[model samples]
Target chain A: MYPNDGFRELDRQECLRLLAKVPVGRIVHTRQALPAVLPVNFSLEEDGAVVLRTAAASELVRAVDGVVVAFEADEVDAATRSGWSVVVTGPAGVVTDPGEHERLVRTGPRSWVPWPQEVFVRIEPELVTGRALVGGRSLYGVRPPKWIPARR
Target chain B: MYPNDGFRELDRQECLRLLAKVPVGRIVHTRQALPAVLPVNFSLEEDGAVVLRTAAASELVRAVDGVVVAFEADEVDAATRSGWSVVVTGPAGVVTDPGEHERLVRTGPRSWVPWPQEVFVRIEPELVTGRALVGGRSLYGVRPPKWIPARR
Candidate 1:
Protein backbone atom coordinates (compact mmCIF):
# COMPACT_ATOMS: atom_id res chain seq x y z
CA MET A 1 0.00 0.00 0.00
CA TYR A 2 1.16 3.59 -0.62
CA PRO A 3 2.25 5.29 2.59
CA ASN A 4 1.95 9.04 2.30
CA ASP A 5 -1.54 10.05 1.24
CA GLY A 6 -3.11 6.92 2.68
CA PHE A 7 -4.82 6.57 -0.67
CA ARG A 8 -3.25 4.45 -3.39
CA GLU A 9 -4.30 4.21 -7.01
CA LEU A 10 -4.61 0.60 -8.10
CA ASP A 11 -3.44 -0.49 -11.54
CA ARG A 12 -5.71 -2.34 -13.99
CA GLN A 13 -4.34 -5.77 -13.17
CA GLU A 14 -4.60 -5.17 -9.46
CA CYS A 15 -8.17 -4.01 -9.92
CA LEU A 16 -9.15 -7.20 -11.69
CA ARG A 17 -7.47 -9.32 -9.07
CA LEU A 18 -9.28 -7.50 -6.31
CA LEU A 19 -12.59 -7.94 -8.10
CA ALA A 20 -12.18 -11.69 -8.09
CA LYS A 21 -11.88 -11.62 -4.34
CA VAL A 22 -15.43 -10.37 -3.90
CA PRO A 23 -18.67 -11.92 -5.19
CA VAL A 24 -20.97 -8.93 -4.92
CA GLY A 25 -20.87 -5.50 -6.55
CA ARG A 26 -22.95 -2.61 -7.83
CA ILE A 27 -23.65 -1.88 -11.47
CA VAL A 28 -24.10 1.76 -12.50
CA HIS A 29 -25.97 2.77 -15.57
CA THR A 30 -27.53 5.95 -16.88
CA ARG A 31 -31.32 6.25 -16.76
CA GLN A 32 -32.07 9.25 -18.91
CA ALA A 33 -29.21 11.44 -17.65
CA LEU A 34 -29.15 10.42 -14.02
CA PRO A 35 -27.03 7.55 -12.79
CA ALA A 36 -28.67 4.54 -11.15
CA VAL A 37 -26.98 1.74 -9.25
CA LEU A 38 -28.07 -1.83 -8.66
CA PRO A 39 -26.43 -4.46 -6.51
CA VAL A 40 -25.34 -7.61 -8.32
CA ASN A 41 -23.39 -10.78 -7.75
CA PHE A 42 -20.58 -11.02 -10.26
CA SER A 43 -17.57 -13.12 -11.14
CA LEU A 44 -14.41 -12.06 -12.87
CA GLU A 45 -13.10 -14.11 -15.78
CA GLU A 46 -9.46 -14.79 -16.59
CA ASP A 47 -9.64 -12.23 -19.38
CA GLY A 48 -10.80 -9.51 -16.91
CA ALA A 49 -14.44 -9.46 -17.97
CA VAL A 50 -17.27 -9.40 -15.42
CA VAL A 51 -20.23 -11.77 -15.73
CA LEU A 52 -23.52 -11.25 -13.88
CA ARG A 53 -26.93 -12.89 -13.78
CA THR A 54 -30.04 -10.75 -13.56
CA ALA A 55 -33.77 -10.94 -14.01
CA ALA A 56 -34.92 -10.70 -17.59
CA ALA A 57 -37.66 -8.32 -16.52
CA SER A 58 -35.37 -6.20 -14.37
CA GLU A 59 -34.66 -2.66 -15.46
CA LEU A 60 -30.99 -3.45 -15.82
CA VAL A 61 -31.59 -6.05 -18.50
CA ARG A 62 -34.12 -4.03 -20.42
CA ALA A 63 -32.10 -0.83 -20.51
CA VAL A 64 -28.45 -1.69 -19.90
CA ASP A 65 -27.86 -4.62 -22.23
CA GLY A 66 -25.32 -3.62 -24.87
CA VAL A 67 -24.91 -0.27 -23.09
CA VAL A 68 -21.87 1.14 -21.40
CA VAL A 69 -22.04 0.65 -17.66
CA ALA A 70 -19.84 0.53 -14.60
CA PHE A 71 -19.37 -2.31 -12.13
CA GLU A 72 -17.87 -1.65 -8.67
CA ALA A 73 -16.92 -3.78 -5.68
CA ASP A 74 -14.94 -3.27 -2.51
CA GLU A 75 -14.06 -4.71 0.83
CA VAL A 76 -14.04 -2.26 3.69
CA ASP A 77 -13.43 -2.38 7.42
CA ALA A 78 -15.63 0.25 8.96
CA ALA A 79 -13.96 0.29 12.32
CA THR A 80 -10.48 0.41 10.85
CA ARG A 81 -11.69 2.85 8.18
CA SER A 82 -9.63 1.08 5.57
CA GLY A 83 -10.77 -0.54 2.35
CA TRP A 84 -10.14 -0.97 -1.37
CA SER A 85 -12.54 -0.45 -4.28
CA VAL A 86 -12.35 -1.55 -7.88
CA VAL A 87 -14.51 -0.24 -10.71
CA VAL A 88 -14.82 -1.68 -14.20
CA THR A 89 -16.49 0.25 -16.94
CA GLY A 90 -17.39 -1.06 -20.36
CA PRO A 91 -20.15 -2.30 -22.60
CA ALA A 92 -22.57 -4.74 -21.01
CA GLY A 93 -24.00 -7.23 -23.45
CA VAL A 94 -26.02 -10.40 -23.26
CA VAL A 95 -24.06 -13.61 -23.65
CA THR A 96 -24.84 -14.62 -27.21
CA ASP A 97 -22.59 -17.56 -27.97
CA PRO A 98 -24.54 -20.71 -27.19
CA GLY A 99 -21.56 -22.70 -25.96
CA GLU A 100 -20.24 -19.90 -23.76
CA HIS A 101 -23.73 -19.13 -22.56
CA GLU A 102 -24.29 -22.71 -21.57
CA ARG A 103 -20.99 -22.80 -19.74
CA LEU A 104 -21.78 -19.57 -17.92
CA VAL A 105 -25.25 -20.80 -17.03
CA ARG A 106 -23.64 -23.65 -15.18
CA THR A 107 -20.52 -21.84 -13.92
CA GLY A 108 -20.98 -18.07 -13.97
CA PRO A 109 -21.66 -16.01 -10.89
CA ARG A 110 -24.90 -16.96 -9.14
CA SER A 111 -27.70 -14.58 -8.17
CA TRP A 112 -29.11 -14.13 -4.70
CA VAL A 113 -32.59 -13.05 -5.67
CA PRO A 114 -35.34 -15.57 -6.43
CA TRP A 115 -36.74 -13.93 -9.51
CA PRO A 116 -36.16 -15.68 -12.79
CA GLN A 117 -32.80 -14.28 -13.81
CA GLU A 118 -32.12 -15.98 -17.07
CA VAL A 119 -30.38 -12.88 -18.33
CA PHE A 120 -26.62 -13.23 -18.26
CA VAL A 121 -24.83 -9.96 -18.85
CA ARG A 122 -21.15 -9.69 -19.51
CA ILE A 123 -19.30 -6.43 -19.07
CA GLU A 124 -16.25 -6.26 -21.27
CA PRO A 125 -13.95 -3.90 -19.44
CA GLU A 126 -12.79 -0.89 -21.35
CA LEU A 127 -11.24 0.78 -18.33
CA VAL A 128 -10.50 -0.32 -14.81
CA THR A 129 -9.54 1.86 -11.85
CA GLY A 130 -9.28 1.39 -8.11
CA ARG A 131 -8.16 3.03 -4.90
CA ALA A 132 -7.39 1.94 -1.38
CA LEU A 133 -7.57 3.86 1.86
CA VAL A 134 -4.69 2.61 3.89
CA GLY A 135 -3.28 3.39 7.34
CA GLY A 136 -6.82 3.17 8.68
CA ARG A 137 -7.43 6.76 7.71
CA SER A 138 -10.76 7.45 6.10
CA LEU A 139 -10.12 11.02 5.09
CA TYR A 140 -7.32 12.33 2.88
CA GLY A 141 -5.34 15.56 2.69
CA VAL A 142 -4.82 18.22 5.36
CA ARG A 143 -8.41 19.47 5.25
CA PRO A 144 -11.90 18.47 4.24
CA PRO A 145 -13.66 19.92 1.23
CA LYS A 146 -15.68 23.10 1.68
CA TRP A 147 -19.46 22.67 1.62
CA ILE A 148 -21.28 25.94 1.08
CA PRO A 149 -24.97 25.82 0.46
CA ALA A 150 -26.46 28.08 -2.18
CA ARG A 151 -29.13 30.58 -1.21
CA ARG A 152 -31.76 29.71 -3.73
CA MET B 1 -40.17 -9.84 3.61
CA TYR B 2 -42.17 -10.30 0.45
CA PRO B 3 -43.08 -13.94 0.39
CA ASN B 4 -43.62 -15.07 -3.17
CA ASP B 5 -40.70 -13.99 -5.32
CA GLY B 6 -38.36 -13.85 -2.29
CA PHE B 7 -38.05 -10.17 -3.15
CA ARG B 8 -39.32 -7.56 -0.78
CA GLU B 9 -39.59 -3.90 -1.55
CA LEU B 10 -38.66 -1.63 1.31
CA ASP B 11 -40.36 1.65 2.05
CA ARG B 12 -38.64 5.01 2.41
CA GLN B 13 -38.62 4.83 6.21
CA GLU B 14 -37.11 1.37 6.19
CA CYS B 15 -34.54 2.43 3.63
CA LEU B 16 -33.29 5.20 5.91
CA ARG B 17 -33.23 2.83 8.84
CA LEU B 18 -31.08 0.42 6.89
CA LEU B 19 -28.71 3.21 5.90
CA ALA B 20 -28.00 3.85 9.56
CA LYS B 21 -27.20 0.20 10.06
CA VAL B 22 -24.25 0.28 7.62
CA PRO B 23 -21.43 2.77 7.96
CA VAL B 24 -20.11 2.36 4.44
CA GLY B 25 -21.74 2.82 1.02
CA ARG B 26 -20.96 3.59 -2.60
CA ILE B 27 -21.67 6.98 -4.13
CA VAL B 28 -22.50 7.10 -7.82
CA HIS B 29 -22.21 10.27 -9.85
CA THR B 30 -21.68 11.29 -13.45
CA ARG B 31 -18.27 12.60 -14.31
CA GLN B 32 -18.16 14.06 -17.81
CA ALA B 33 -21.09 11.85 -18.85
CA LEU B 34 -19.50 8.74 -17.35
CA PRO B 35 -20.72 7.20 -14.14
CA ALA B 36 -18.17 6.88 -11.33
CA VAL B 37 -18.65 5.21 -7.98
CA LEU B 38 -16.68 5.76 -4.79
CA PRO B 39 -16.93 4.10 -1.43
CA VAL B 40 -17.75 6.39 1.46
CA ASN B 41 -18.55 6.28 5.13
CA PHE B 42 -21.78 8.06 5.97
CA SER B 43 -24.47 8.76 8.52
CA LEU B 44 -28.18 9.38 8.26
CA GLU B 45 -30.32 12.09 9.79
CA GLU B 46 -33.85 11.69 11.09
CA ASP B 47 -35.09 13.66 8.11
CA GLY B 48 -33.64 10.98 5.81
CA ALA B 49 -30.81 13.02 4.37
CA VAL B 50 -27.36 11.44 4.21
CA VAL B 51 -24.14 13.11 5.39
CA LEU B 52 -20.52 12.22 4.75
CA ARG B 53 -17.00 13.59 5.26
CA THR B 54 -14.30 13.69 2.61
CA ALA B 55 -11.02 15.33 1.75
CA ALA B 56 -10.96 18.68 0.02
CA ALA B 57 -8.78 17.43 -2.82
CA SER B 58 -10.66 14.25 -3.60
CA GLU B 59 -12.38 13.70 -6.92
CA LEU B 60 -15.68 13.11 -5.10
CA VAL B 61 -15.42 16.52 -3.51
CA ARG B 62 -14.65 18.30 -6.76
CA ALA B 63 -17.21 16.44 -8.86
CA VAL B 64 -20.10 15.65 -6.54
CA ASP B 65 -20.55 18.70 -4.36
CA GLY B 66 -23.84 20.36 -5.25
CA VAL B 67 -24.66 17.52 -7.62
CA VAL B 68 -27.32 14.87 -7.74
CA VAL B 69 -25.94 11.42 -7.07
CA ALA B 70 -26.89 7.92 -6.05
CA PHE B 71 -25.73 6.30 -2.82
CA GLU B 72 -26.11 2.55 -2.25
CA ALA B 73 -25.38 0.15 0.60
CA ASP B 74 -26.13 -3.51 1.15
CA GLU B 75 -25.32 -6.49 3.33
CA VAL B 76 -25.49 -10.04 2.02
CA ASP B 77 -25.15 -13.21 4.00
CA ALA B 78 -22.67 -15.25 2.03
CA ALA B 79 -23.76 -18.49 3.60
CA THR B 80 -27.48 -17.84 3.37
CA ARG B 81 -27.33 -15.98 0.09
CA SER B 82 -29.78 -13.43 1.40
CA GLY B 83 -29.37 -9.68 1.67
CA TRP B 84 -30.91 -6.25 1.28
CA SER B 85 -29.85 -3.08 -0.50
CA VAL B 86 -30.87 0.57 -0.25
CA VAL B 87 -30.30 3.37 -2.73
CA VAL B 88 -30.67 7.08 -2.10
CA THR B 89 -30.64 9.72 -4.80
CA GLY B 90 -30.61 13.46 -4.35
CA PRO B 91 -28.77 16.71 -4.70
CA ALA B 92 -25.60 16.85 -2.58
CA GLY B 93 -24.35 20.16 -1.33
CA VAL B 94 -21.88 21.53 1.18
CA VAL B 95 -23.52 22.13 4.51
CA THR B 96 -23.84 25.90 4.60
CA ASP B 97 -25.67 25.97 7.87
CA PRO B 98 -23.09 26.61 10.54
CA GLY B 99 -25.11 25.08 13.35
CA GLU B 100 -25.83 21.89 11.43
CA HIS B 101 -22.27 21.57 10.19
CA GLU B 102 -20.87 22.03 13.65
CA ARG B 103 -23.25 19.49 15.10
CA LEU B 104 -22.42 17.01 12.35
CA VAL B 105 -18.71 17.42 13.03
CA ARG B 106 -19.21 16.69 16.68
CA THR B 107 -22.02 14.10 16.67
CA GLY B 108 -22.51 13.28 12.99
CA PRO B 109 -21.04 10.26 11.30
CA ARG B 110 -17.33 9.96 11.94
CA SER B 111 -14.74 9.06 9.29
CA TRP B 112 -12.13 6.32 9.46
CA VAL B 113 -9.63 8.27 7.44
CA PRO B 114 -7.49 10.52 9.67
CA TRP B 115 -7.39 13.53 7.39
CA PRO B 116 -9.00 16.68 8.79
CA GLN B 117 -12.15 15.79 6.84
CA GLU B 118 -13.76 19.02 7.90
CA VAL B 119 -15.56 19.17 4.61
CA PHE B 120 -19.07 17.85 5.11
CA VAL B 121 -21.21 16.98 2.13
CA ARG B 122 -24.92 16.49 2.65
CA ILE B 123 -27.11 14.72 0.15
CA GLU B 124 -30.74 15.66 0.65
CA PRO B 125 -32.46 12.60 -0.71
CA GLU B 126 -35.15 13.00 -3.31
CA LEU B 127 -35.73 9.29 -3.75
CA VAL B 128 -35.05 6.27 -1.62
CA THR B 129 -35.68 2.72 -2.80
CA GLY B 130 -34.70 -0.66 -1.48
CA ARG B 131 -35.16 -4.41 -1.97
CA ALA B 132 -34.43 -7.49 0.03
CA LEU B 133 -33.87 -11.10 -0.93
CA VAL B 134 -34.66 -13.44 1.89
CA GLY B 135 -34.96 -17.24 2.42
CA GLY B 136 -31.49 -18.04 1.06
CA ARG B 137 -32.12 -19.02 -2.52
CA SER B 138 -29.06 -17.82 -4.44
CA LEU B 139 -30.26 -18.56 -7.93
CA TYR B 140 -33.34 -16.89 -9.31
CA GLY B 141 -36.08 -18.04 -11.70
CA VAL B 142 -36.86 -21.33 -13.38
CA ARG B 143 -34.96 -20.28 -16.49
CA PRO B 144 -32.28 -17.59 -16.78
CA PRO B 145 -32.40 -14.83 -19.37
CA LYS B 146 -31.60 -15.84 -22.89
CA TRP B 147 -28.10 -15.07 -24.17
CA ILE B 148 -27.17 -15.42 -27.85
CA PRO B 149 -23.86 -14.33 -29.33
CA ALA B 150 -23.89 -12.18 -32.46
CA ARG B 151 -22.54 -13.82 -35.55
CA ARG B 152 -19.87 -11.40 -36.72
Candidate 2:
Protein backbone atom coordinates (compact mmCIF):
# COMPACT_ATOMS: atom_id res chain seq x y z
CA MET A 1 0.00 0.00 0.00
CA TYR A 2 2.98 2.30 0.28
CA PRO A 3 3.43 4.44 -2.77
CA ASN A 4 6.16 6.75 -4.04
CA ASP A 5 8.62 5.34 -1.50
CA GLY A 6 11.28 4.37 -4.02
CA PHE A 7 10.15 0.80 -3.46
CA ARG A 8 7.44 -1.27 -5.09
CA GLU A 9 5.87 -4.47 -3.89
CA LEU A 10 6.46 -7.37 -6.22
CA ASP A 11 3.65 -9.76 -7.04
CA ARG A 12 4.00 -13.44 -6.28
CA GLN A 13 5.10 -14.23 -9.83
CA GLU A 14 7.78 -11.60 -9.73
CA CYS A 15 8.87 -12.69 -6.30
CA LEU A 16 9.41 -16.25 -7.42
CA ARG A 17 11.33 -15.13 -10.46
CA LEU A 18 13.71 -13.05 -8.39
CA LEU A 19 14.12 -15.85 -5.89
CA ALA A 20 14.99 -18.36 -8.58
CA LYS A 21 17.63 -16.08 -10.00
CA VAL A 22 19.72 -16.20 -6.84
CA PRO A 23 21.38 -19.34 -5.55
CA VAL A 24 21.97 -18.09 -2.04
CA GLY A 25 19.61 -16.86 0.63
CA ARG A 26 19.50 -16.47 4.39
CA ILE A 27 17.25 -18.63 6.50
CA VAL A 28 15.80 -17.14 9.69
CA HIS A 29 14.73 -19.36 12.55
CA THR A 30 14.83 -19.62 16.31
CA ARG A 31 17.84 -20.92 18.18
CA GLN A 32 17.94 -21.08 21.97
CA ALA A 33 14.77 -18.97 22.05
CA LEU A 34 16.53 -16.28 20.03
CA PRO A 35 16.51 -15.53 16.35
CA ALA A 36 19.27 -17.01 14.18
CA VAL A 37 20.15 -16.54 10.54
CA LEU A 38 22.13 -18.81 8.22
CA PRO A 39 23.03 -18.51 4.56
CA VAL A 40 22.64 -21.43 2.24
CA ASN A 41 22.57 -22.01 -1.48
CA PHE A 42 19.14 -23.25 -2.41
CA SER A 43 17.22 -24.49 -5.41
CA LEU A 44 13.51 -24.15 -6.06
CA GLU A 45 11.27 -27.03 -6.88
CA GLU A 46 8.69 -26.95 -9.67
CA ASP A 47 6.06 -25.74 -7.26
CA GLY A 48 8.42 -23.08 -5.88
CA ALA A 49 9.34 -24.96 -2.74
CA VAL A 50 12.87 -24.28 -1.48
CA VAL A 51 15.20 -27.24 -1.05
CA LEU A 52 18.62 -27.20 0.52
CA ARG A 53 20.98 -29.72 2.00
CA THR A 54 22.77 -29.87 5.32
CA ALA A 55 24.37 -32.49 7.51
CA ALA A 56 21.76 -35.02 8.60
CA ALA A 57 22.73 -34.54 12.22
CA SER A 58 23.32 -30.80 12.17
CA GLU A 59 21.67 -28.59 14.73
CA LEU A 60 20.03 -26.62 11.94
CA VAL A 61 18.20 -29.73 10.84
CA ARG A 62 17.06 -30.39 14.36
CA ALA A 63 16.05 -26.82 15.03
CA VAL A 64 14.24 -26.05 11.77
CA ASP A 65 12.38 -29.20 10.90
CA GLY A 66 8.60 -28.82 11.02
CA VAL A 67 9.02 -25.25 12.25
CA VAL A 68 8.22 -21.99 10.59
CA VAL A 69 11.20 -20.30 8.96
CA ALA A 70 11.80 -17.28 6.79
CA PHE A 71 14.03 -17.36 3.74
CA GLU A 72 15.25 -14.25 1.93
CA ALA A 73 17.18 -13.73 -1.27
CA ASP A 74 18.14 -10.48 -2.91
CA GLU A 75 20.32 -9.04 -5.66
CA VAL A 76 21.56 -5.47 -5.52
CA ASP A 77 23.99 -3.45 -7.56
CA ALA A 78 26.26 -1.33 -5.44
CA ALA A 79 26.82 1.22 -8.14
CA THR A 80 23.14 1.79 -8.89
CA ARG A 81 21.82 0.89 -5.45
CA SER A 82 18.95 -0.96 -7.12
CA GLY A 83 17.74 -4.47 -6.43
CA TRP A 84 14.90 -6.75 -5.50
CA SER A 85 14.49 -8.90 -2.41
CA VAL A 86 12.15 -11.83 -1.83
CA VAL A 87 11.20 -13.44 1.44
CA VAL A 88 9.34 -16.73 1.84
CA THR A 89 7.83 -17.88 5.10
CA GLY A 90 6.43 -21.30 5.70
CA PRO A 91 6.73 -24.55 7.55
CA ALA A 92 10.02 -26.37 7.03
CA GLY A 93 10.01 -30.13 6.84
CA VAL A 94 12.73 -32.71 6.35
CA VAL A 95 12.14 -34.85 3.32
CA THR A 96 11.45 -38.35 4.61
CA ASP A 97 9.68 -40.24 1.88
CA PRO A 98 12.20 -42.54 0.28
CA GLY A 99 10.76 -41.97 -3.19
CA GLU A 100 10.79 -38.20 -2.82
CA HIS A 101 14.27 -38.37 -1.31
CA GLU A 102 15.48 -40.36 -4.27
CA ARG A 103 14.02 -37.79 -6.64
CA LEU A 104 15.61 -34.96 -4.73
CA VAL A 105 19.01 -36.59 -4.78
CA ARG A 106 18.97 -36.38 -8.54
CA THR A 107 17.43 -32.93 -8.89
CA GLY A 108 17.99 -30.90 -5.75
CA PRO A 109 20.94 -28.73 -4.78
CA ARG A 110 24.09 -30.63 -3.97
CA SER A 111 25.76 -30.07 -0.65
CA TRP A 112 28.36 -27.32 -0.53
CA VAL A 113 30.24 -29.24 2.12
CA PRO A 114 32.32 -32.31 1.54
CA TRP A 115 30.35 -34.26 4.10
CA PRO A 116 28.22 -37.06 2.81
CA GLN A 117 24.68 -38.24 3.55
CA GLU A 118 23.17 -34.82 3.56
CA VAL A 119 19.50 -34.40 4.41
CA PHE A 120 17.01 -32.43 2.38
CA VAL A 121 14.81 -29.80 3.96
CA ARG A 122 11.93 -28.30 2.04
CA ILE A 123 10.37 -24.94 2.88
CA GLU A 124 6.86 -24.61 1.56
CA PRO A 125 6.14 -21.22 0.04
CA GLU A 126 3.10 -20.45 2.13
CA LEU A 127 3.69 -16.74 2.43
CA VAL A 128 5.74 -15.05 -0.25
CA THR A 129 6.56 -11.36 -0.22
CA GLY A 130 8.98 -9.20 -2.15
CA ARG A 131 10.00 -5.64 -2.77
CA ALA A 132 12.07 -3.87 -5.40
CA LEU A 133 14.01 -0.68 -4.79
CA VAL A 134 15.18 1.38 -7.71
CA GLY A 135 16.94 4.66 -7.42
CA GLY A 136 14.12 6.32 -9.45
CA ARG A 137 12.34 3.77 -11.54
CA SER A 138 10.31 0.59 -11.39
CA LEU A 139 12.14 -2.68 -11.88
CA TYR A 140 9.53 -4.12 -14.20
CA GLY A 141 8.67 -0.89 -16.01
CA VAL A 142 10.82 2.01 -17.10
CA ARG A 143 9.55 5.38 -18.15
CA PRO A 144 11.42 7.87 -20.32
CA PRO A 145 12.38 11.25 -18.91
CA LYS A 146 9.68 13.89 -19.30
CA TRP A 147 11.83 15.74 -21.82
CA ILE A 148 12.20 12.63 -23.98
CA PRO A 149 9.63 11.68 -26.61
CA ALA A 150 7.23 8.87 -25.86
CA ARG A 151 7.92 7.34 -29.31
CA ARG A 152 11.44 6.62 -30.60
CA MET B 1 33.43 -27.38 16.17
CA TYR B 2 32.46 -28.69 12.79
CA PRO B 3 35.41 -28.24 10.48
CA ASN B 4 36.22 -29.32 6.94
CA ASP B 5 32.87 -28.24 5.64
CA GLY B 6 34.36 -25.71 3.25
CA PHE B 7 33.37 -23.15 5.83
CA ARG B 8 35.22 -21.58 8.75
CA GLU B 9 33.74 -19.99 11.85
CA LEU B 10 34.66 -16.35 12.30
CA ASP B 11 35.37 -14.67 15.59
CA ARG B 12 33.52 -11.67 16.90
CA GLN B 13 36.12 -9.20 15.69
CA GLU B 14 36.06 -10.60 12.16
CA CYS B 15 32.30 -10.65 12.12
CA LEU B 16 32.12 -7.00 13.09
CA ARG B 17 34.67 -6.07 10.46
CA LEU B 18 32.75 -7.83 7.72
CA LEU B 19 29.48 -6.38 8.92
CA ALA B 20 30.89 -2.86 8.75
CA LYS B 21 31.99 -3.44 5.18
CA VAL B 22 28.45 -3.89 3.83
CA PRO B 23 25.91 -1.13 3.47
CA VAL B 24 22.81 -3.31 3.54
CA GLY B 25 21.62 -6.39 5.37
CA ARG B 26 18.46 -8.26 6.22
CA ILE B 27 16.75 -7.92 9.59
CA VAL B 28 14.76 -10.88 10.84
CA HIS B 29 11.94 -10.64 13.33
CA THR B 30 8.52 -12.03 14.12
CA ARG B 31 5.21 -10.75 12.71
CA GLN B 32 1.91 -12.32 13.65
CA ALA B 33 3.86 -15.16 15.28
CA LEU B 34 5.53 -15.96 11.97
CA PRO B 35 9.08 -15.08 11.03
CA ALA B 36 9.68 -12.14 8.69
CA VAL B 37 12.76 -10.68 7.04
CA LEU B 38 13.30 -7.25 5.60
CA PRO B 39 16.29 -5.62 3.93
CA VAL B 40 17.53 -2.33 5.28
CA ASN B 41 20.54 -0.09 4.91
CA PHE B 42 22.24 0.17 8.26
CA SER B 43 25.17 1.82 10.04
CA LEU B 44 27.21 0.52 12.93
CA GLU B 45 27.67 2.41 16.17
CA GLU B 46 30.91 2.46 18.10
CA ASP B 47 29.91 -0.56 20.14
CA GLY B 48 28.78 -2.33 16.94
CA ALA B 49 25.07 -1.82 17.51
CA VAL B 50 23.19 -1.61 14.19
CA VAL B 51 21.33 1.62 13.46
CA LEU B 52 18.87 1.76 10.60
CA ARG B 53 16.24 4.27 9.56
CA THR B 54 12.63 3.42 8.94
CA ALA B 55 9.41 5.31 8.74
CA ALA B 56 8.32 6.31 12.22
CA ALA B 57 4.96 4.63 11.64
CA SER B 58 6.22 1.57 9.87
CA GLU B 59 4.98 -1.86 10.86
CA LEU B 60 8.56 -3.00 11.28
CA VAL B 61 8.96 -0.56 14.11
CA ARG B 62 6.01 -2.00 15.96
CA ALA B 63 6.76 -5.66 15.28
CA VAL B 64 10.38 -5.47 16.35
CA ASP B 65 10.41 -3.05 19.23
CA GLY B 66 11.42 -4.63 22.55
CA VAL B 67 12.01 -7.95 20.79
CA VAL B 68 15.06 -9.94 19.84
CA VAL B 69 15.98 -9.63 16.18
CA ALA B 70 18.56 -11.10 13.90
CA PHE B 71 20.60 -9.16 11.35
CA GLU B 72 22.69 -10.73 8.62
CA ALA B 73 25.19 -9.45 6.06
CA ASP B 74 27.41 -11.24 3.62
CA GLU B 75 29.72 -10.81 0.65
CA VAL B 76 29.91 -13.58 -1.87
CA ASP B 77 31.74 -13.92 -5.15
CA ALA B 78 29.62 -15.88 -7.56
CA ALA B 79 32.52 -16.75 -9.83
CA THR B 80 34.58 -18.51 -7.17
CA ARG B 81 31.67 -19.54 -4.97
CA SER B 82 33.47 -18.07 -1.95
CA GLY B 83 32.15 -15.65 0.62
CA TRP B 84 31.69 -14.68 4.24
CA SER B 85 28.45 -14.26 6.18
CA VAL B 86 27.76 -12.85 9.61
CA VAL B 87 24.68 -13.04 11.80
CA VAL B 88 23.94 -10.77 14.74
CA THR B 89 21.19 -11.61 17.19
CA GLY B 90 20.10 -9.16 19.85
CA PRO B 91 17.41 -6.90 21.22
CA ALA B 92 15.93 -4.14 19.07
CA GLY B 93 14.82 -0.78 20.27
CA VAL B 94 13.74 2.55 18.93
CA VAL B 95 15.89 5.58 19.66
CA THR B 96 13.84 7.55 22.15
CA ASP B 97 16.16 9.91 23.93
CA PRO B 98 16.03 13.30 22.21
CA GLY B 99 19.79 13.62 22.61
CA GLU B 100 20.43 10.26 20.98
CA HIS B 101 17.93 10.97 18.24
CA GLU B 102 19.55 14.29 17.46
CA ARG B 103 22.99 12.68 17.45
CA LEU B 104 21.82 9.85 15.22
CA VAL B 105 20.18 12.30 12.83
CA ARG B 106 23.63 13.81 12.39
CA THR B 107 25.74 10.64 12.10
CA GLY B 108 23.45 7.73 11.32
CA PRO B 109 22.19 6.45 8.01
CA ARG B 110 19.68 8.74 6.37
CA SER B 111 16.33 7.54 5.21
CA TRP B 112 16.49 6.29 1.65
CA VAL B 113 12.92 7.30 0.98
CA PRO B 114 11.74 10.84 0.66
CA TRP B 115 9.81 10.64 3.86
CA PRO B 116 10.30 13.15 6.63
CA GLN B 117 10.72 12.36 10.30
CA GLU B 118 12.16 8.88 10.09
CA VAL B 119 12.85 6.73 13.14
CA PHE B 120 16.11 5.13 14.13
CA VAL B 121 16.08 1.56 15.38
CA ARG B 122 19.12 0.11 17.06
CA ILE B 123 19.88 -3.57 17.36
CA GLU B 124 22.45 -4.56 19.94
CA PRO B 125 25.08 -7.06 18.94
CA GLU B 126 24.70 -9.73 21.60
CA LEU B 127 25.34 -13.10 20.01
CA VAL B 128 27.51 -12.39 17.01
CA THR B 129 28.48 -15.36 14.85
CA GLY B 130 29.95 -15.63 11.38
CA ARG B 131 31.31 -18.09 8.85
CA ALA B 132 33.44 -17.89 5.73
CA LEU B 133 33.25 -20.17 2.76
CA VAL B 134 36.37 -20.02 0.67
CA GLY B 135 36.36 -22.89 -1.74
CA GLY B 136 39.68 -24.28 -0.58
CA ARG B 137 41.01 -21.74 1.89
CA SER B 138 40.07 -19.77 4.96
CA LEU B 139 38.89 -16.17 4.72
CA TYR B 140 41.02 -15.10 7.66
CA GLY B 141 44.16 -17.18 6.87
CA VAL B 142 44.99 -18.19 3.35
CA ARG B 143 47.12 -21.28 3.04
CA PRO B 144 49.52 -21.85 0.17
CA PRO B 145 48.84 -24.63 -2.28
CA LYS B 146 50.62 -27.83 -1.30
CA TRP B 147 52.76 -27.73 -4.42
CA ILE B 148 53.91 -24.12 -3.80
CA PRO B 149 57.17 -23.60 -1.93
CA ALA B 150 56.91 -22.33 1.64
CA ARG B 151 59.16 -19.33 0.97
CA ARG B 152 58.41 -18.69 -2.68
Query: Per-model C-alpha lDDT, please?
Result: 0.71, 0.74
Model 2, A10: alpha-carbon shift in Å? 1.5
Q: Provide the TM-score of chain B versus the true chain B for each model in turn.
A: 0.80, 0.84
What C-alpha root-mean-square deviation, in Å, does candidate 2 show against the real structure? 7.5
| Maximum-TM-score candidate | 2
lDDT of 1 by residue, B52-95 (tens): 88665555666788888988888876556567888888899878
In angstroms, the error of model 2 at B5 is 5.4
Best by DockQ: 1
Tens-digit lDDT track for model 2 on A1-152?
Answer: 12334456799899998898887888888888888777778889878799987767777787789999998888865446677788888999999999999998899886554344667899999988877766544543553111000111
TM match of model 2 to true structure: 0.86
Report the C-alpha lDDT of model 2 over B78-121, residue by residue, as the tens digit.
Answer: 44667888888889999999999999989998555434457789
DockQ of each two-chain model:
0.27, 0.24
When only the first chain is scored, the TM-scores of the models are: 0.79, 0.84
